[model samples]
Target: MTAPASPGGGSVRPEVALAFAVVGYVALAIFGLGMTSLVTNQEVISVPGLGQLPGIVGMTLSTAAFAGGLWAAVRRPHPSFWGVPGAMLGAFLGYLVGIWGAAVIGGTDLAAATAAMGMLATSWFGLVVLAAALVCAWSGIALVRTRAGRPRWPWERDDE
Candidate 1:
């Protein structure tokens, strides 16, 4: 069998990194919103530790998506430092889209939605973006440290 390709060489192209970051963040936002709505729209008994389930689920999904995006970006033959900035931009834009969508669905005008959500909600959204950025950065760094190839399983033979 041919040997695996090397991980380092050309850096990740800006356009490719941006595209991946945007797609990943948007998908994460959509999934998070859907999960939150599903959990909160239903009336169920309040469990002691389950009160924050929706928020937890949303955060978890977003974090996973951000990390996955970073991993994919860095795994490109030409991994670059641009992935971190791309991730931040994508996270901010995706959160904006989520806010706009929620406002539209709630039958509120943009101005009214902003007023309704108030400063605290806006701050929370910012926090979410920050968290996603950090996750993406961490993932990118980890990927950069590793070799590019399918990991060997314990049950698999050393020789391919």
Candidate 2:
């Protein structure tokens, strides 16, 4: 639950971390699908049973960000920038999971369908996810913590 720190990030209060996690997932869900639709020429986001695709990209990205943020939050270094790599790695892994998941949900071949899953990476979706990760990563760091606790301005804290 604790990572070695070398210029790492501050230990975020649990509530703040939880809040950021919620906001990150929701933000990525919207942004991921928005970017996907924009690039794929879809008027609206795709669904699980849409055609041959599972339409789970948005969900995957959001989940990945959440997982990655958690990882970064708990990392020893706690470096603010750690979220970038953590979330990106999470996204890639999430994509693989999506491939298999789509195969299962769509009743298709996981092996054969793997090659066709390049649309997201090959398109603008990758960039969007990266942006989302950065946003997600900074969520807690931006609070300007004065002490090890919830995000409140210095003036808001009462002397104990």
Candidate 3:
């Protein structure tokens, strides 16, 4: 929504544009996966062991959805390759806290909730989160690109 090329914003910040774009991509990805699951009548996504905990799966999935976008918003603005990952990690910790609070409020057992966090951190789900973060981080970087240097269609390449 904030891309400089996006209309009506008057040169909006690159980071903000990246954030918006990343979020849009993430949403589309999830929607597509959901649709695919519906069409096939099968589970295309799973959380490994977290699914057994009461509300943990939902909370984790909900937080996992946007945490990377938060990281990407700050990341591609400038490639602070070092600092950005740390910030991304902080955002992840915050997500865990949010999950904890929400789960407890929702009356999920404290031990179960705690265990769920442990399982998530140690499981392949952690890699999934990291992969998601990387995807979100790189995607917005492309939006700021002014030109595509690769092969173009006939009309585009044969400009008058």
Candidate 4:
């Protein structure tokens, strides 16, 4: 994979590290679950509606993974390094888990379920996340521009 850009290269490495960590975790979970299913000689771990549970942990890891990326991105002079892509991925994972859980609980057809998954995986969530990030970035730029280079602290910033 192409190495992602970074503020100082070190910061970017953390996101890569986090991605590797998540992959390791996913491997462990799959291995453990496979072993469990083997020992039980049943479909214990591969229950039809339970796939999303693993995804919850996956999304949690992804959120942390991309959050680190976001931090690194924000530290850059551009401040948009990997933020949009990272946040978009994080949001997509979150959406995946949410929609999967809903589908499982709602007993939706596989087509519908797959469609929902496709919506997130095919960059719908990314678009939404990009829009949100742009809004925040613009607001931040405006604030820094108008506030004499001093960031307005949340506690001190007015609600208007």
List TM-score per model, in order.
0.44, 0.59, 0.51, 0.34
Model 3: C-alpha RMSD to truth? 7.1
User: In order, what is each prediction's RMSD in angstroms?
Assistant: 8.9, 6.3, 7.1, 14.3
Cα lDDT computed for each candidate against the true fold:
0.48, 0.53, 0.47, 0.45
Lowest summed-lDDT stretch of 10 residues in model 3? 1-10
- How many clashes would you count in candidate 1? 4
Error of 3 at 132 (Å): 0.5
Ranking by lDDT: 2, 1, 3, 4
Which stretches of candidate 3 lie above 4 Å from their native place? 1-16, 19-21, 24-87, 145-153, 156-159
Q: Write the per-residue lDDT of candidate 2 for residues 1-160, one digit (tens) a residue.
A: 2422223344455445546755775578567758767777863322233353544653555465556555555443443545456665575556545754665667656544453455555556655655665666555444322234446667776753
lDDT, residue 94, model 1 = 44
Ranking 1 against 4 by lDDT, winner:
1
Better of 1 and 3 by lDDT: 1
Best by TM-score: 2
**Ten-residue region with minimum lDDT total, candidate 1:** 42-51
Stretches of candidate 4 exceeding 4 Å from the true structure: 1-69, 75-80, 119-126, 134-160
Count of backbone clashes for each model?
4, 6, 0, 0
* Residue pairs in candidate 2 whose N, alpha carbon or C atoms collide under 3 angstroms: 3-76, 4-76, 8-77, 8-78, 9-78, 9-79
